[model samples]
Structures are given as structure tokens and as C-alpha cells.
Target: MRLLELTLPDAVENVALDEALLRQVEETDGQPVLRLWELESYAVIVGRANRIERNVNVEACRRDGVPIVRRFSGGGTVLLGPGALVFSLFLRVEKDRHLANIDAATAIVLDRVLTPLKGLVASLERKGTSDLASEGVKVSGNSQRWLRSTFLHHGTLLYDFDVSLIERYLSDPEREPDYRQGREHADFVRNLPISRDELRKSLTEAWDARLDPPELPFDLVRDLVRDRYRNDEWTFRM
Candidate 1:
């Protein structure tokens, strides 16, 4: 597994970078990967096949000047911006069982990437096929794509994001269906007790024991975005 830390300008680049990595993992039949980074600004991302108008509050986004983008993977709508930590895991299927369904695929990610964050209160657990919860509240949301036996797992970690902005910008103003039973952005999302570097170091150390590290030139990710993600059709395809 190669570990890569990328410091990039927050644009629509993540979507393209994820696609490129999925292709690279399939092409080389590579080891698992732990790719870490952060968003430089704000962006609204919806799942593939989601109706942008229905899933996102377009008027709220427009009023707030928030850019909306779509990801190549499937998951609920989410907001990414500064104070959010993003991580993507690229893995090669090791067994037939791991390729069977989304549930299993997500379980694998939870075990590898989140189970070790024990110091952050409680260890993470799957809230659904693509969510990680701590102390009965969600701390992260994930999405995945499996291409030719390779898995691309990407998600956002709310280290210290603006919880209030979620109510202002997300399509769900009330968080009715989901937040009915738990702490949500406006009510509870908070900054971690530890620093970004410390948390990252802990995450990296946990990943070190799982796969071999490879130095993927940052250029590969940079070039893919310029050619694909920063396009109007890809961002607002409603």
C-alpha cells in the first residue's frame, strides 16, 4: 500500500483524482492505498445518479455562493470545505467475498481506516453501508466504487467543520429523516481534541502495517483534475 499526502487547492479536482486512482489500481493490480488530503474551500458534492435539484437545495447553495459538484461514487449528498479531512482508500480485491456487495466493501474500509481511531472517544462503527459513527453520532461519511476488481473508497472527516453551514447550505434544511435520532451538524459536529497533524499521524501509522507504500507522483492527480473535474458539465449536471 502506498501512502500519499496531498495538499491541494479545493476545486472539483477530487472527483477526477478518484477516477484516475481507480484506473491506476485496476491497471497495475496494485496494493491498498491510504490517500490523505484536505479541502481548501467549500463545495457541495452529490452522489452519482442523484437528482441535483431534488437532493440539494439549489437556491440555498446559490444564495450562499456554494459550488456544487458530483462524485463518481454512490452515497448521500455531503458538504466538503475547510476543516474537513478527506481520505481515499484504493484497494485490490483479495478474496471473492470482498467483491460481493457494497456492505462488505464498506466493512473492509471501516476496519482498515477507522477502527483504530479509538483515542477519539470510541472506535468507529458502520451506521449504514457508508457512514461511520462515534458515540452514536456520525463523524464521517463514505462512498465507494469498484472497477474491475479494484475498490476506490473516499470520504470526509469532520474534524472542525462549520456545522451551522450545513443547515444553511445542505438540501435538507431540517435534517429531518436522518438527524431525528442523533447529533447533527448544527447540534454537535465539532473540532477534535487533537491537532490535524496528530490525527493524520495516527491514521498513517495504522495504515503502515496494512500495505506497502508507494510514492505516487502528485502530478498524476494534478493532471487528471485539470483535464476532467473543473468542467461545467461535470459539476452541475442536473
Candidate 2:
């Protein structure tokens, strides 16, 4: 898989890039990609069809001047900011049963990701559906979007995030996986006690990902940011 080492200015462009790359691969039958990026500021990202009012504290977000954006994937709301490492995979789905089913996909991907972290951390495991946990606290949260021929799997790995921000902007998710067990965000999510470079190196090496420019159509990404991600109509549409 080719790696795209790029980070945009904000959540909107970054999120738009994920979908843009997915479209590029599907249209061109391009090689699978592994994109890694980090946020320099704070933002709250809701799932594609999630109700923002139910998942986010609007008043808090407004007061803090943090942008609340929505991505084109189905998952729980997430807090993104400094110390958060995002890894995205654009893969072609052939006869791989693991990629065909959501549960199987989550398991297979998490397992592969954990392989590199196993020696760095003790007792890393998958909790709930797509969460990677260590000693009962989540270190990573993942979600997916699929097309007829390819699927986009992306996730956030918390390396050293400010856990307090989660409670400040996000409400208790309306829907949660079984293992969550009603735990509050601050108590449930924890940073991976590892350095950013270590985490990135492990992930890139695990997938044998090579570094390269995406060569994607930037026009589509800009259009997506303007028309969908930046528009409150689409961001807030449940």
C-alpha cells in the first residue's frame, strides 16, 4: 500500500480528503492507500448520519470556538486535536471475507494494527466493535465507509490527547458498543502511552506502507469541503 503523508489545515479538509481519495481509487482502480495525518487544532467530528444534538454539547463547542464537522463514515462522534494520530486505509474489496462484513473487517484490521503495538504496550485488546483498548480503556476508535468495489477504513489513535476535551465537548454517545458499560468518556478513553513517532512507525511498517503523494484530484476535495463538510446544512443533517 502507498502512504500519503499529508495533513490539511483543519478538520473539514482532512475529512474531505479521505472521501476524495476513496473516490479517486474507485474511479481509477488505483492502488490501495494508507494516509496518516494529525490535527494541529481541536475539532469535533460526528458520524455521517449521527444526530449532532444528541452526541455533542453544542453550547460548549460554540463557546470554545471549536468547529464541529461531520465525516462521510458511520461511527460515533470523536474529538480530534493535537496528539491524535489518524490512519486511513483505502482498500479494494475482492473475495476477502474479512473486508465484506463490518464485524469481520473491524476484527481483522484491529488485529493487524495491534501486531505492531503488542511489544510496545502490555495487554492491548479490541473492545466493543471497533475500539482498541488497553486495560479496559480505549486507545483507538475506528469507523468505515464502503463502495461497491472499495472500502475506506479509518481510525484515530490517541497517543497523548487531552482527555478532558472529550468530556468538555462530547456528550455520552446515544449508541455505544456493549463493552462500553456506561463508562463516561474521560474514564473510558486513554492515551496510548507511546510517542507519536513510535506509533506512526509501527503502523506504517505493519502494513508495509510506502510513502508517496496521493496524486488525488484536489478539486473534488475542495468542492466537498465547500459543499458538504463546511456547510452546516449537511453537517447537521441527521
Candidate 3:
């Protein structure tokens, strides 16, 4: 697999690049890719179909000058800031047949990727469809999007994140796993007691990925940002 460890200066671009990589690979039938990135500032990423008014505190984010954007995948909304590590994996469904089914793919992929993290966070286990939890609180969350032959599995690893920010921006998710038990964000989520480097190492080791910077699809990423991610119509359409 190829490795890309970069954070685009713009949050929209970072989100766009995740889809760009998946598209680029599907177009070329290329190898799998592992991308690691972190945002230095706070941002709100809603699922493709999520309604901001229902899921996020739009006025609070606007007053604070934070960008509220939508990603190309379907999952719960998440608050991202400095201390969060984002890892995206692009895989060919033809090569990995496990990815052909959404539920099984999420479980198989997460279990494989999170094996090395057992040492980093004791008692870490997957709680719902795509959450990695420790003890009794949430630590990591994941979501997905797939194309004709390739799929994108990306998620966040909260190492030193401020869990309080979640409640400040996002409301309680409308679609909750039974395990959540109606607990609010602050009480339900917690950061992993680990460093970004440690998390990155564990993921890289799990994927057996090499740090090879392949030819990036910069034009596609820019186009996607301008056409989708940065467009307010696309963000609030739902």
C-alpha cells in the first residue's frame, strides 16, 4: 500500500483529498493507500446526508468562525481539532473481497487495524458498527464510502482531544447505537491516552504500508473542494 502523511492547508481540501484518492485508485485499479492527517484548527464534518440544523449548533460554529462542512461518506457528525489523528484507507474491493459488504467490511477492517492499539489502550474494543472504545467511553469513530471497485475507510483517533468541544458544536446524534444509552457527548466520548505518533505507528504497522508518496490527484482534489466540500448548497442540502 502507498502512504500519504499530509494535511492540506485547508480543511475542505483535506476532506476532498480523501475522496480524490479513492477515485484515483478506482480509475487506475491502483494499490491501496493509507493517508494520515490531523487538523490544526477546529472543524465540523457532517455526514453526507446529515442536516446541520438538526445535528450541529450552526450559530455557535459560525460565531466562533469555525467551518461546517460535509464529507462524501455516511456516518455521524464529528468535531475535529488539534489533537485528533485522522487515518483514511483506500482499498480495492476486487482485491479485498471483505469490502464488498458494508457491515462485515467495517468490522473486519477495524478489527485488523486496531490490533496494535490494544497495547496503547488497555481493554480497547469495538462497541458499535465503527467505534473503538476503551473501558466505558468512546475513543475512535469510523465511516465509509465506496465506488465501483474501491472504497474509502476513514476515521478519527482522539489522542489528546478536548471532548467538551463535541457538545459545544454537535448535538446528540439522531441515530445512536444502543450502547450509547442516550449519554451526552461529553460523558460518552473520551480521548485515547496516547500520542499521535504512537497511533500512526500502530496503523502503519497494521496496514504494512510504506511511506511512498504516489503521484497525487491534485486537480481532482481541488475540483472536489470547489464543487462539493466548499459549496454551502452541498453542505446544507439535506
TM-score of each: 0.82, 0.97, 0.98
Pairs that clash in candidate 2: none
Best by lDDT: 2
- Please, what are the lDDT tens digits per residue for candidate 2 over residues 116-185? 9998997899888899999988999999999988889999999989998899999999998888789999
Worst 10 residues of 3 by lDDT: 93-102
Candidate 1 wrongly placed segments (more than 4 Å)? 95-99, 173-185, 188-192, 209-228
Q: Report residue 71 deviation for candidate 2 (angstroms).
A: 0.7
Look at candidate 3 and tell me the lDDT of residue 216.
95
Clash tally, candidates in order: 3, 0, 0
Per-model root-mean-square deviation over C-alphas = 3.4, 1.1, 0.9
Q: What ranking emerges by lDDT with the best candidate at the front?
A: 2, 3, 1
Question: Which candidate, 1 or 3, would have the higher lDDT against the true structure?
Answer: 3
What lDDT does candidate 1 reach at residue 202?
Answer: 67
1 against 3, candidate with superior TM-score: 3
